[model samples]
Target: MPDRSSPETRAVLRAAVPPARRLLPVVLLGVASAGSSIALLAASAWLIARAAEQPPILYLSLGVVGVRAFALGRATFRYLERLTGHDAAFRQLASIRSGIYERMLPSAPDGLGMLRRGDLLARFTSDVDDLQFVTLRAVQPFVSAAIVLVAAVAGLAFLAPGSSLGVLACLVVGIGAAVLAERIAADRGARRLAPLRGDLQSAVVEHVTSLETLVAFDAAERSRTRIADLGERLARATRAQAASAGAAAAVMSALGGIAVLASIAGGLPQLASGRLDGPAFAVLCLVPLAIAEVAAAVPVAVAAWRTARVSAERIATAVPAEPPSGVVRPPAAAVAFPSGAGAPTLALRGVRAAWPETGTPSGPVLDGVDLDLAPGERVLLRGPSGTGKTTLAHVLVRFLDYGGSYRIDGVEAAELDPAEVRRRIGLVEQRPWLFDEDLRQNLLFARDTASDDELLAVLDRVGLGEWARERGGLYAPVGERGVLVSGGQAQRIALARAMLADFPVVVLDEPTANVDPDTAGRLLDDLLDAAGERTVLLIMHSVEVPAGVDRVVELTGRG
Candidate 1:
């Protein structure tokens, strides 16, 4: 299946930009910088011409001063453009990161589960950083350089027409060669980055997540060796990219030399024929040198262009496992689950699915499965490892594709809209994630606008109200993944977040896996008690199902 976010990702990213009015200052700065570059070149040429004519001391001094001021102005504009452009790029990247994350929440078990932690980190850090180059440097530098080149050519033509035309022709050829070189190298660059980046990310994830295990098993050396191997591969790939960029740079330099030579050849003949003077001839030669700076940016532009496309392709391939098409509707109109008997029911009839990579055709994880849960039914799903319990949970949430028919209040689950399915269901995975923020922010995961009263109420329901109050309540930081809180407390916080969603269906994967028996029982009681008006689907491996759960179902086979 293709990712749904690809086609529209560019559009979504663009929407994050500031208004045109806000960008006008940046554009004006670019114009000023370009004009300054041309002026600086022209002044330098005039200074050289005067030095040769009679070496007028006053003109020489003034010209030097003028050139310095021009350079300063150019530098100032360049800095301002970079500052504003990068600022805008970072803001847009933040918005893009958020959007991608939001889209992945419900589709996580389907697509995100397939990604390594390090690769996903790359998406937020490296890939997003690459876009800064694309948005700020890639396009802007080319535009500014082109403008300066055009202005320089015009100034040269006023002094020596033949030389100006010669330089322009050479520039055209140089650009063409650089573009061709880029095209030839782009595919190889992408291919080289693929396994190399993937391997590095994979190794980093494995090493970091298993650091304790590796040390305990005395396998740290082995892990370090594997990381070293990945680093070497990455270095080789980077070298290849650099080599291609170098070739393009060489081409630009060679062409610049040819252009300068042509200018000199044309100007010298004009000077001998009495059509040009020595000072003017020297000025004409300076035109090509000024134009060369513009050509120098070509290689960087090419590299940035290739990198942006590769980054886009990587992100597009990862999110939205299946392409988005028509608007996705909910599985049920109103808390419908279990099927025929009405009210709100969820049921699966022989649903089957297989992981794409392994190509292992397992039986329908819920093989000929039949389930019925009424409103307020807190059912505990019991199964052993590899029994497809997790897979079943994902299907219930509409993340994975299923073969057989599954219905929510008679509506086919497949026909329901994805966003609607998500809005109607809340999930608490085994490893519940909490961002590095305060408890208040974490509790508002689904409802950012949730009131203080609502937040406090949910916290109290999860049995953390008193503890949180003592620790400063909402203002207290939770650290990364609720590290500041105890395992049982984190579990309760996660439950509170899910409960606060007020969704019709709530799903959890081994919520008590890390909690003590007493806490686990208390947490279960809190969840079931609060679920008075909602349905709960608890996925657990242990046979110790919570007392008073509405129902219990067991899976017999491993698929």
Candidate 2:
């Protein structure tokens, strides 16, 4: 078992199982299919016995025909049953994936950032695939197995009440064997499998993302060695599960064989004495074996459950659910900074935030820093590296947590809905993100409804109108992460996105770092001209401050 004492693991279990209420129909269908299959098997034995006896030729042919129909009917129902169960599994997996992504949005950046890209990729893909298989196969097989066991008992009871007791005893033995197999194999299997999956994913992701680095460093062999290790771990887990399942199957089959042998030995005398029919006696023997076959499948299914539970728990713990409905408010607003001391547009006071892995400290990244600005005020934040300039911007946006108060427009920032809070601030990070889509779509990311004229106007404002026109206008594809465009073009396109946001405040960080000197100069000129009606807080590293009557706050000192 996992260390459920960890709050993160507990949270994951809670989230994964919450929406699992939809699994009821899947259970019902599985039971119905298994029960029908058992019934058809028993009917086939009876029909076969009647055909062997010297009955009318037509009657024997009819019995053969009936067996064929029964087999076909069982196949049809089995297909439908599996289809319904798998469909639910897929939907639940999607919900779990979505939940994990939502949780990552608000998690500690340091903690989240520490995770390997390959591990997360494995979780979203193969781990998710395992979940679908587990939910559909694990629970359904047990459910269907139970139904088969119960129906077989009922059939035996109707044909020969005394024999039903022996069959029930076999089921009891099978259940115990299945439980033992699950207990012995699950934890070890999960331990081996989880890391194996994560490593495999990490290896592939590392190779792809660091292809340039790898080739530059001449380290392809090292990567291949690591992948081989991961494969070995996966093979070990597979072998362990297979061995446990083989043991369980052996035990269940032995018990079932004993039950069938005992029934035949005890009932044949009764049949010879005319107390039981040969046909009914034959069914009693065959039905128990059929139930045993299904019971044998249970051990494999249980082993899968181990892997599934681990996957579910991992996803649940990593993803954050929607917090309770009411908005949470911090106690007080930050002190207004000396610059533009009017009603503060954004403020932070006595704030501290850190990872759970790191104990809460008196000094956070923001470190109780106080800042304030008025509407339409252009403030440049110039700080030495590692002084939490970016962290402060995130705190202002409420993307990160802090100890004291952060507020917008005098109201505590926490009081406002996160979605509503974001609407007021337009942010640009150092790296400009462009999609594989057309230039127009990348620019109008959150505002798809913007008309072509509206999009062109914003591009013009960011000094990209002529650039777009040169590339066949807005419809030109930028390729993935704007690979088709130059670094300067990518930045301009990002600036166009921020400009079109039309929020009252624009926060841009190191926008010119990636651009050429001429493009950077032109971009600065256009941005200053377009800054006519908005508050622009720029965290600048290189580009000189636009010549304007605005205050500059220099952040210095270190931890």
Candidate lDDT scores, in order, read 0.72, 0.68
Cα lDDT of candidate 1 equals: 0.72
For candidate 2, write residues 1-559 as lDDT tens digits.
2334356554544443324456666676666667666666777887778767778887667657766776776777778777877777677777767867766665534346556778887877777677775666576677667676777777677777667876777677766766686568655876677768788888987887677788889997788788888888888887877777677767877877877875576567668789888677878777777777667757666666676767765565433343221112232544332233322377667765543334334445556576777777888887778777776666666566566777677676766565555666767777777888998779777577899999998888777788889989989999977779887667667767766766667777776778777877676666767656778787875536666628887776521
The count of residue-pair clashes in candidate 2 stands at 4
lDDT (10s digit) by residue, model 1, range 1-559: 0123456545543544445664556666776777777678768887878787886587589889989998999899989987887777777778777867776664455545556777777766666666666556566666666666777778777777788888889888888887677657654765567556766887888897788899999999998998998888788778777777777777887887798898887677789999887666766766576577666675576577566656666665556655232212245544443333213677777776544333344434445556666666788888888787877776777776677787777788787676566667777787788889999988886688899999998888878899889999898899976678777777778888877777778887888888887778887777677665678888899888787787898876732
Q: Give the 10-residue window scoring lowest on summed lDDT in candidate 1.
A: 323-332
Off by over 4 Å in 2: 1-25, 57-69, 108-111, 161-165, 178-187, 213-224, 242-259, 319-362, 366-372, 402-407, 412-415, 469-475, 516-519, 530-532, 547-549
Among all candidates shown, the one with the greatest TM-score: 2
Q: What lDDT is obtained when candidate 2 is compared to the true structure?
A: 0.68
Could you tell me how far off, in angstroms, the CA of residue 410 lies in candidate 1 after the best superposition? Answer: 5.4
User: What is the overall TM-score of model 1 with all chains considered together?
Assistant: 0.76
lDDT of 1 at 530: 63
Model 2: pairs clashing at backbone N, Cα or C within 3 Å:
12-316, 12-317, 103-320, 352-403
